[model samples]
Target: MRTQSHLRIGDQPWVKWSLITLALTLVFLLLLVPLIAIFVQAFSGGVSSYWQNLTDRYTLHAIGLTLFVAALTVPINLVFGVFLAWLVTRFEFPGRKLLITLIDIPFAVSPVVAGLLYLLLYGANGWIGSRLMDQDVQLMFAWPGILMVTVFVTCPFVARELIPLMQQQGREEEEAGVTLGASGWQLFRRVTLPNIQWALLYGVVLTNARAVGEFGAVSVVSGNIRGETNTLPLHVELLYQDYNTVGAFTSASLLAGIALLTLFVKSFVEWRQARQRAALSEDEA
Candidate 1:
């Protein structure tokens, strides 16, 4: 009996078109519509109104606070992630697997729960907070607490990106560098950094996106104090609560703009990574 060769599922034209149509419909309804609506409503009162809302003192403060959090969050996580990734991928020790598992705690735990955990540990009545408070230091209900939760939530991104790539690349190149008398810093800067830079940048982009847009944990820890502890996301909520539709959407549009910028950067990094892979393939060939 004869059989068809090169057969594949969903090869029919009708099935292909149906899938495409369904995906586009979902995209339009779920993503595009909301994104468009944000801009539409933001400028509904005209450009001057939108600009006024954006330049409002509270709005400006929120924007500044959000950027401050992201700026701090990215670098701290970047260093920590690189260190953790290197330790796990390059060494064998007790609790190595457990350490790797613990890296995922941020992802596994709910953001709100994570915020509460911080609050419990660092609130005025709590063990650590009671001592810190004696010295007139406060963490919870302030910027420090916001930064802590943001860092906790975004910590996994860079390491997650690097770990698999590092494992696959292995220590051969690094070992060779060491044998040739390269120092640890030199070896990482020259050998490992070049190979994993794209993944590192991709991870940074994701971390920044999450850090900038973080709301739930930040809201809980920040005390939602307008023009002070409030970040952009919290400010948007405040605007909406105050029945300032234009202001709310204006703040939201800035966030949406940030998300778009992140998507663009992520796509660029992926494209660059793809090109690098192709070049390496050609060299091998």
Candidate 2:
């Protein structure tokens, strides 16, 4: 069973340390160092000042808005992601591969491009927006636009995670459930859901993280109309522009903390998925 890599890359421990140190240096300097620098700048104001900046109502509202967008976006993407995963995996239809590939349009498409798509579709002169304008409806410059595009950008997260997982699990268990007179809902809730729960959840977590952190396109579409349209990322930019570095950094720290919390959550999800995959193999055997 023992395969390769028992020997050092060059059969030298010292060389290995040098390589490791170099790799760490590259990672730390490029990524970690800058991140730490932001924290250093943020906290340089001391705890009391940072706390006050964090407690500011405007900053709090921005955080709330970010959470609100994530709240709406994550679930929508969760539903869409799972449905698309199931659709592609469970059935064949016209243009199936094309549609599945289109799901990833968000990845190839810039967030800015996604926003612009919405903007063009919903803007006063744009197709949908022009039609909706007869009713005086606004989507491009409001929370609706923000949420939809976030969902669009992150929609593939869950489905992409689940498809491979569901594919690997194969359809036999679900088919078995169906064969045993289980209803569609019952089979899904009992058999299908349980099997893919971890992958689904992992996707949701990733979706949430990206939703909370989204900018660029959200910026273009949101109109940044002060308290009404501002999200945390936009709010940070606003503060930075206005020379409120302390407040901006305070907000940045909150986002940073959220990112860290998500990492742990995502790690646990991966662990759960791994465990489930193992259990599934045992059951099949």
In terms of lDDT, the best-performing candidate is: 1
Candidate 2 achieves a global lDDT of 0.88
Give the Cα error of residue 108 in candidate 2, in Å.
0.8
lDDT of every predicted structure (CA atoms): 0.95, 0.88
The TM-score of predicted model 2 comes to 0.93
Top TM-score prediction, candidate number: 1
List, residue by residue over 194-255, the lDDT tens digit for candidate 2. 88889999999999999999998899899988778899999988999999998888888888
Off by over 4 Å in 2: 1-9
Alpha-carbon TM-score of each model against the true structure: 0.95, 0.93
Scanning candidate 2 in windows of ten residues, the lowest lDDT window is 1-10
Candidate 2: residue pairs that collide: none
**Candidate 1 — which pairs collide?**
none
Q: Where's the lowest-lDDT run of ten residues in candidate 1?
A: 1-10
* 71-176 per-residue lDDT for model 1 (tens digits): 9999999999999999999999999999999999999999999999999889998889999999999899889999999999999999999999899778999999
